[model samples]
Target: MRDPFAPDFFETPVAPEPPAPVEPVQPVPSFPHRPARSMAAAMLAAGLVVGSVAGGAVGAVLVSHRNTGTSPNAVATVAPGVGAPAASPGSFAAIYQQAKNGVVTINASTSSGGPRSFSQAEGSGIVVDTQGDILTNAHVISGANQIRVTFSDGRTTTGQVKGVDQSADLAVVKVSVSADQLHPLPLGNSDSLQVGDTALAIGSPFGLQGSFTAGIISGLNRGTTAPNGRALTGMIQTDAPINPGNSGGALLDGRGQLIGVNDSIQSPVEGNVGVGFAIPVNRAASLLPSLEKGVAIQHPWLGISGQTLTASTADQLGLSEKSGVLVVQVVPGGPSAKAGLRADGQASANDDVITAIDGHSITTIEELTQYLDTKNVGDRVTLSVTRNGQHISIGVTLGNFQAQPSATP
Candidate 1:
């Protein structure tokens, strides 16, 4: 063998130290690489499977809860922005206070043949002025020898008759109360009053002094017949509580102004039936200034009983083309008779139907009276009538019914 270093051919290339044991290099990792389509499909399938089960369970619970009962939050409640509705008592109280002061309790006694004879009646009156003048119903003081008025302040005084309008059921009385205690209530315009307006009545009903009641205006321009067969025109109807002694009291508006004078009540029971009538203050006031000045009042009278022209009557009288009043009957020597106006006499002839007075169209007796009211007692008026299928005009001078005194007391 050769040298030991040169060993054998098998171990020959052992390799020169194996090339110094070449170092192996390691590769770097990238972001977790995945197949995008495959991952997305798997996630979608999982979501569908979870959503189906959860949705069904939630629907079941909602249905069960709905069938059980209403939720606590479902109850109704008033809103903070709203308030309850009510009426104001201030208006009513103020009107009552102002009107009651003008109201006075009236008591009258009529004498028979003997000194022991006594017939007493109680009523209410309104103070018209500081001069001690008072207004009451004519029937209250009718045939009375002595009359007394009691104020709310407990002052009583003897009353003297100034004058009486039997037709209107109004009378004026005079008392000697001081001016300090004589505050007259402000009068309002009743003609402008509407239905359903608030009304207040103050009086001494049943001798209960300073009694007050409240209501609303139920009607207007109502026609009422007196017990003596006299017709009261232009009456105001109300539902205010009125009793026996409320007559001649004051009917006031919400503003504490006098609107009317309480005159009558329609009741079948012992208490109020809510049907009451009053004379409009405007109508009554028109006559007040004259009476206060001691001027005699002369009421104009048409002197004929008539009625509203109904459709049937309108057709029968050939008034199909017109609307007017039909004169039923005429009194002898009355104003209409003196004016040569023909009425339904023994001869059944269709006299001319009155269609208008001056320029006003006559419809009801109330309408006719209202037209007549526009003129004075001695004033002359022209009536437009539909007669014999022709229109004719007639001039008439009104007569004073009050001027004719009753032959009997």
Candidate 2:
């Protein structure tokens, strides 16, 4: 396990700044549940830099900080597809057999070779349409000179880039496979999924063709980093052992519905550590049209990175609400900056509190960005903030956020 003291992570817009030390506030029991998160950061399991990728090696990209702590359970491993298929069609065996046909192995290569004369990377994708439209992680095919998608039936076809939404770290690739050859995985309503629900992961983990793993939805609305150093919001957290090549694979529910896209794995060694994350299918479904249109998809950006405001932290700062996000840094010329938002103050006495958005109470930085997802670039919204003791409303038009600060957000 990496030191919990180390740092790297989700780009709330720009990368996060180290949180200031806070005086402990009394824990308010009735308040929303906010887990104490380590300020530590890690790289996405598959988002290696272009240079490292040029060597045909997979470097870490997503940050996985939490170690579920040791338990007294006996060690045991279950073989895939051991359960009764008829009783639970959504069983591990059923989901694997039913979905593996739609799951495709993606091999990407570039002639700009380094160690390997031809740099190559392998990942997974899901067939989303009969017309050859498939979905995978953007980083999987990032910078590929050629893409080849192979199905369980051993049918291979040239893959064309449809479009990539780097903010979500998702890409749609189109192939010329016949409709009969394509078995589209049904996209499930992620909103219906809850913690403890069955989650089946299918993809090419570590280039192993047609692999399957079963686990439960460990968490929801989880936040993680994308390939482009941006924050991916509302991610699904699972205990399934997703590995390096599992990026862009299918994270399905027991019913064999594609609920999430397997993307981030929790590992210090770029392997599986039992925890992994997936982009919710709802997020992918929302951006599918724009992706298919070959247009850039824009997720709203406030351009400032801050820490989650804990109830204890909020009370320690003398804030009224038991919940709210503390503003630590406001990027110059960002929507919040232009609206005159203040960064962390000389001490905790001065940190600006983002209390609400349009009236929706915000308690975490994830909630803030998730709310922004409902809006678009150029859409104006009123922000309710508490600076010092006074409450103020600031109207700001959100700006479109790309990779990094190329002239503000």
Candidate 3:
């Protein structure tokens, strides 16, 4: 998220520099010569940075120039920074130091086994309040009969699930760690994040506790398919390496404020591929109030199955607007159906479109989701629609998605 008053993100810390490049040596007239293969190998090794982050893939390659009999001591000029300059190391170190106490490594097992051989799994969490509430990924503790939380200070205690939203892939866990074992992490505004901004991820990636990686925000407002089979919108995309165990970890900004929750990674192999997605803190933050209250949180459903509008359809419908959602279907007896909203059909010939919601123009599902996410269940919204040859507005009360009947509606 960008700070309007400040040009640079004040929270994110800088990344550590790659190792300095090594130069191949030309034998001095009297010095004993090492084997050519050995010299080449040494040169190759020197060019690598060797960090665990997937962002370093390109940096791990060897870059060489043709031999022109230059002095062995020659050095080539590398770019000032790779991809994009990340936050400075000293700043990151401070952020990590400040937030480390708030993050805890989670261990879970089954009650059927004795303490020694209990089923064990590791994940990360962030302390959201002084009340010992920890926010983590639901998959981390799912199906575990018992949960054990190990704070950054190495203290272990049993934890209880406060509230779990499987659709959101988030679970709020509670451990009775007193104030002494905690430091609450500051949540930032993820809605303002833009591409090219710095992102710092800290977690126990691949079981390596307190591991840190830095990269740029490659994209924002991304649609993500959660491990729990829910489609999450408004996701933050980063180049930072987010391994399996890193789920629920903190995605910090330049100033070290928590901007996102590390949750999913895109990779062909099991290893990192530099493309990772995080749940925007703003999204998580919005839902947490109800979660902490121990109530089942509900989202306002539009009751319409729609796809993004295309240019051809926009022109055909005479609604050549940039912001509109093309309605594909309206579920029978659902809110949309009851509201008398029409979906694409032979009569209209798929010419009608939803141009706005409650006065807000929405061009894409991302915008539509954001509009819906801000509202609670039972809130009435007005949809501005175009049909045949006229524009009309319809009022519809958003329904709780969880309350929708599983049977055909």
Candidate 4:
């Protein structure tokens, strides 16, 4: 399996003054290859880059900082959740008009090593409520000493990072402003979105504020890596021409309701190649309560890596299970190891095949991951496993996903 964290496989744009380089963390182990399909190959071809558009001098860099501390004094106002009405699809122009005001331009400045040197990063954000709670990508404000938010009405104000979840690449910024100065966008159900469904993206692309683009939801349940090298599953893939500075922007449906957050682009070059990935709004909405409270969100980690087993692959490998996840490696001292789950050894025999989790059948990595996403850290779950053709259930406790330093040039 090829390394997905290879230098050439991913790039992040940084600007103005470059910060001191940090040590690159080790890459996650590769999963077993499928017979005719390889996820790693596809990722390599479509290089992933953090889509925060940079101004001034551009350089290749990726910076990630994790802050899980709670702030008791911080307060945020979240928009009320409303279901999307059953209305006819609106035109892109109509959608833009409805959602443009809810989007804002974000500028974050990070201090360099020098006493007076600082670097600026620019991206877009969505106003979730009239009280000035804005949602953006975590990478946009990571390690920032100061933040500035520009509203659609040309109003600019100082912003504060209320909360950030780097594992999901999401953050919340708050500003002190009157309710009349804000326009909150309603959150839509991303699960209702389908292939060919209309997707309108509004953001500051290349510092172009209020830039709007139209495309269809090209794919669903796509998996990608976050800026911190954590796996982000159940992503919404689109060809909406999302560029740098579009990060943390809104991906709305035809009804002008927010469905996803523009996160990253898959392009060999720095520019968009019509392939962009967005974090599902449902996930973002789920995290809003905790994020708005200035409480860092911690994702549940299973602490194991594996590949989805198919009928063809099972027959080829002479395995017992036709469809399941083949446990290739389990991290020592991790939750799976603590639960006594067996991993494939050097002999590749006696490997444990995970068929289900808490009575939910999982046939693909995406299914397993999506199920896990709904769970909280420290939750106890039962894993249905098949080891040497014997079925058994193992109870395991989940743990928080630790952010690792990723290799970024």
**TM-scores vs. true structure, each candidate:** 0.70, 0.74, 0.67, 0.73
lDDT of 1 by residue, 1-409 (tens): 0001111111100101111112222222211123321111000000001001110111111111121123222434678988644324444544465557778988876777787776666678887666677877765676788888888786889999876766566778888767778656666678899998877788766555677777789988876643233456777887877666677788877676778888776544334566677888777766665554445666677666666777776666555434567766666787777886776652223665678888877766678876776677778888887666778888878876532221100
lDDT of 3 by residue, 168-240 (tens): 7677787786655766776666778889877888876544556688887998877654333333577788887
**Between candidates 1 and 3, which one is better according to TM-score?**
1
Question: All candidates: CA RMSD in angstroms?
Answer: 43.2, 13.7, 17.7, 15.2
On residues 205-298, what C-alpha lDDT tens digit does candidate 2 reach at each position? 5455676777788998876666665655777888876765677888877667778888765555434555678878776766666776677777
Provide the overall lDDT of each model, using Cα atoms, as 2-decimal numbers: 0.60, 0.65, 0.61, 0.68
Query: lDDT per residue, candidate 4, 240-314, as tens digits?
Result: 777666888888876677888887777555556667888887777667757766777777877776777888877
Clashes of each: 0, 7, 11, 1
Task: Estimate the TM-score for candidate 4.
Answer: 0.73
> Residue 226: error of model 4 in Å?
2.8
Whichever of 2 and 3 has more TM-score, that candidate is 2
